[model samples]
Target chain A: MKNIVIIGGGTGGTVVANRLANRLYDQKDISITLFAPEKNHIYQPDLLFLSLDLSDPRRMFRDEQKLLNKKVNLIQQPVDAINVDNKFVISKGKKYAYDYLVIATGARLVPDLIPGLAGNNNHFYDYSSAMQLRDKLRGFKKGVIVTGVADVPYKCPPAPLEFTLLLDYKLRKYGLRSSVDLTYIYPINSIFTIQNVVPILQKEYDTRNIAYKTFFIVDHVDPEKHEVVAMDGETVKYDLLVLIPPHRGQQIISDAGIGDEGGWMSVDKYTLQEKNHEEIYGIGDATNLPVSKAGSVAHFQSGVIANNISNSVLGIDEKINYDGSTMCMTEIGYDKGLILLFDYSHPPYGLIPSRLNHLAKVFYLDYYFANMMYGLP
Target chain B: MSDEKVTKVIDARGSYCPGPLMKLIENVRLAKVGDVLDLLSSDSGTKKDAPNWIKKTGQELIGIYDEEGYTRIRIKKIK
Candidate 1:
């Protein structure tokens, strides 16, 4: 009867919670408790569409309670702290001790890190901020709409490109298409991190005639002035701004001396187990993997993490290895998209495309609704 | 709908997560509002990913069949 505590009920956390629940279903002694902050679970990937008004924004989320399995206990409370040394999770002024723990808090987007980001206008990076930007984009009719990355390792590297394309479609439909000067700003040398999809996206940009401002690292945003200042002293003004903020790990990880220089959880590439603590396992954006922080990577790592945790609990040797598999879909427009697949072990394994590959993304959506949203095993 | 559409076709035999779902999305786009898009994927993670995506997109999932080669799912797009 071992107690397994999983923290954060997002992509990685939810998969681990459900997988463990099924593995220990017949065992009355193995208790699985999941701690998360909100009752509503937003499919973070859909934010790209939501920001651009391409899809029904209401479809982005459902009550978290509706998503989890019946066998697992759900705690809707912000984790105040994690006493890793003591092997307990502290949340909402309460603490639960566990024989084993899984850290899946993912990454935190810090708008405050950039100057003038949170001014009276609008900005976004994470869930709450993206929602705010969604509202702001609704009434916006024209002017410079500048979308840029504040820092590196932000979740879903292809998201910025998706936003740009969708915004192009939005403006064109609104008749103010010619009025809105849309510019996609990024610090990276290219539009996408995955090299193979770069050509596809560049074609989309050219077809849409969207402006591109590369190598402009946003240093700060001035809300009252309606402008974003770059680190190089160049300023880009905007009527509405969609910015991907700087990302960092949870405070608990940094406080516990378990994070890298960028405040990301440091873990071994082959084994997701913490580099410092063998008992601690991490998945999703929390890990300092040099890959794009997307949902597919988390799903791929969850299997590896679950296998290792199960073996450790049963005192059996673990045989799984984390290969850092991630897949991304770049939405070219309303009716068209591109699929990019990569094995991080191979470092940007270019783009391999087939008609079958596109179906995989659509099939994943149905799979999540039936198995995850409905609380099915 | 004939034997071609009825017989199971696991197109995602060697594909990954969004790869399978992206195909379904395109197929559904090609389909009329009531037409069905059937997909087969090898990734077990689809157990959670596929359904959640349908719920978000408002697509109707007709059925899901689990077989030896892969998992099959049928979805119909609703306007």
Candidate 2:
């Protein structure tokens, strides 16, 4: 019998576990197990809407145990370390051997990397932070609100932009738009990495009268002075600062000596197989792929990894490649949204902002919640 | 579509995508058989999703009328 153990039961891991169970169910010699530390599976995208009082926070999370297939074993324990050479994982003082290993432990947000950034600024990435920001916004009357990204490769690339747009709408609704000064500071030269969407976003920024600073790499924050210092010796002062901090991979990957300098697993861009280890594979934000670290990208990677793992077990030479296709449905506020689709070989094709796309984004969350309760799609 | 009187009218014009659909589904659950329900939604996804849901649940769809900025979806509870 062969044992397939997957770590991290987030979007990628959950989808991979379910799909693998469907493909290998009839085979008596294979067993599947998923290790996740959290009991609740969060629909992260809705956090943006939740902060803006547009969505219900209660609907954004569900019991993680209900999301997996009945055949898959679930061990809810934090991983202590992974012994790759020994082909085993140690969690909570117990070691489990695996014939095959799949790593889906997504990125970790490191706020402390930037000095004085954490506990001094507001961010709405996670559930608690979103709730905190909601309260802060409710009490906010008028001030200079600055939103910035400290580093790149953050999850949900369009999230910071969405927050700014939604904040603009919220402030206008509160009749404080004129009193507040809103600015977006991006590490890159453009508001978006995709060149095609720059003009469209820039036009919107101009129309909304929202100030934007490009090439502003945040080096540190001075809470007393209410300023953020850039690496190039530039500084921006603010009354309220919202920051997306630098992200890194799980510490266990580095502890196992299987990750790169940034602690992200090194995998083939097309095959998604670990570069040095054939028995291991990776998907989602945990891998050092040149793709946006978003849930949609992880969902797409789940398909490729599931197919490749199935072929490996069946002893078939056939392999399916992932084209690095990713799409982001961005909420541009005022009940409208836009879509940007791209792949490794092609540039992003931007769609005009419409109310339909906004509906689609909302529908996606509803479908995701329903699917999680019912099992595999 | 105007000849038949609507038993209930759901004013979900300003609500987001799944919000309108969820309201329609909730109201449908509380409605009796042959009860006609009207939903006004500005979200474009509900224009298609509501009809699809009605067909899936073995209900009757009267018609969808285009309004100024929103769509009016009419359905009957047959199941």
Model 2 Cα lDDT, one tens digit per residue, A1-377:
88899999889888888888877878788889999889999998998888778888888887888888887899998778888888999988999999889999999988887788988888878899889988888888888999968765578888989899889988888889999999999865568655568788888888999999875667789999999987556789899888887788888888888876567887887888888888898889898666778888888888888788877887888888888788899988888999888776565675699999999998898787665544444
Identify the candidate with maximal TM-score.
2
Residue ranges of candidate 2 with Cα displaced over 4 Å: A371-377, B1-79
Where is the poorest 10-residue window by lDDT in model 1 chain A? A344-353
TM-score of chain A of each: 0.90, 0.97
- Mind giving the per-residue lDDT tens digits that candidate 1 earns over A107-192? 88666767677553344445556677777777777688887676665788777777777678777877877878888887644565
Minimal lDDT window, size 10, model 2 chain B: B14-23
Q: DockQ score for model 2, please?
A: 0.01
Write down the lDDT that model 2 would get.
0.82
